[model samples]
Target: MQRLFGFMCLVLIATAVPASAQERLKVVASFSILGDFVRNVGGDRVSVTTLVGPEGDAHVYSPTPADAKKIADAKLIFINGLGFEGWLPRLVQSSGSKATVVTATTYITPLKLGSHADPHAWQTVVNAKTYINNIRVALSAAAPADAEVFKSNAEAYRAKLDALEGEIGQFIGQIPSHRRKLITNHEAFGYFAKEYGFEFIAPVGVSTEAEPSARDIAAIITQIKKAKIPAIFLENLSDPRLIKRIAAETGAKVGGTLYSDSLTDEKGDAPTYIDMVRHNIRTLRTALEGVTMRG
Candidate 1:
């Protein structure tokens, strides 16, 4: 009888442990980059659902009924904020979700171009650290039981980001100041250019939906020729036609495709946040340096 009682107690304890471990917080990230940040911090404690998947454009993203349902079911919703997701407010209201909305870019000082604020804060490594910290706080609040786990994960990830920042600085340092000018498909890289001491000229405004007028195109072409800019880059989300046209007229090379608002699918080059930054810098360096070499 004593042996049987002991065996029954051990079985009950084993079952309870697994049940407790299986309870994960449901989180919805607005896009792919924010989704990656949440996953790194949340680890086993969260189940993340991204509205905008790999290579998907958020500027013009149309949230479906299924997306609304996902938001309604989630315990937490993370967003990039700063007008990046123009459709998010309506979607949240339509879903009538009670989920706690956390803006990852809340604390960073934004850079402005004319009257609009740049929403690509994650382009700079230091701002990315702030994002991780904000995520850690939000996750800890949502799941107090797993707060330490979130903190530990964030610390590890921040260390990796520190190393990445150093690597970017060193790499960009190799390019001479005069040769650091390039053009892209859109105004997404202002934060990156400001952080890394590069000049980025774009034909379109910050939002991908904003089309460049003939005057805008003509002025950019003139600038490229007058400045003797060597490289023009095509963004992953923008139409390549405009960039190609500019490149052809200016006698500039199409440097490479840059991952701006969204990441690539799993099998592609920039599947993760860190990988995306590294790939962009390497691509820029290779194209710009190649021009310098030939000249």
Candidate 2:
């Protein structure tokens, strides 16, 4: 096994083991990205159920009684925090789950959002490693019997993350610095912009649920015109009208769609978490490298 380092903590499973060998730690991850991280680090040691499944919109999701049952029975609950899952507290209470509720993004320095904390830390692979490690620690905490296993799994997964981060850096570097500015539908790419040294603008702010007022929209259009942002992009979970109107009003070409709130369809380019990151970098690079602002 690879050596383990520290900056953040890890949760090792030390509690009662399930009766069967196949028996695993019952874990409920608040959404797809966190759920995927838990799966990767937990490996066969845990059973993770995702509350927000593939292409599921977390911003507008309404949890049902069934989800409440899952949370109550889970050994641990993992949420992205940073106001990403505003609906979680009530669900946990309704479920009567005393299970440890851990923010998977707890280890990352979350970007100070416009009004709320940005929970999309997983966008940056470095921060993603934080989520991976925290999930390992959370699983370990809930089921301590698998402490060593969780550590081993976390170490291995983190190595993969290291490799992934390197690749993302190299891939992003391929795009000329001047061309790296991203204008997207929401503030979802803030961490990505920060980590990659790209300046990004969103007609909308952090939460997809918040609608931009006429003044806000006008200001965004004015900013777009002043900045000459070449391409305005659509996000997975937001309405297309705002981005489209901004692009039209600003005369910026529409960039391809970006995955902000959800993963791609199961059969599409970014179906899996790993693929999702790679696809995003690839998409951004292609669009940024090729696009030019009309004279």
The candidate that achieves the highest TM-score relative to the unseen native structure: 1
Each model's C-alpha lDDT? 0.87, 0.78
Q: Which candidate number has the best lDDT?
A: 1
Off by over 4 Å in 1: 1-21, 204-220, 235-251, 291-295
Where does candidate 2 stray beyond 4 Å? 1-21, 204-223, 235-253, 291-295
Alpha carbon lDDT at 261, candidate 1: 85
Q: How accurate is candidate 1 locally (lDDT)?
A: 0.87
TM-score of each: 0.86, 0.80
lDDT of 2 by residue, 1-295 (tens): 2334332223233234443465788889998878878888888888889999888889889999999999999988999888899999999999999888898777577787777788788888888878887887778877888888889988988888888888788878778777677677667888888889888876543334566677777877787788877766745325678767877798776677677666666787677678788777777776776633221
lDDT of 2 at 16: 41
Candidate 1 structure quality by residue, lDDT tens digits, 124-203: 88999999999999999999989999999999999999999898987798989888888776678888998888898864
RMSD to truth, every model = 4.0, 10.1
Structure candidate 1, residue pairs in collision: none
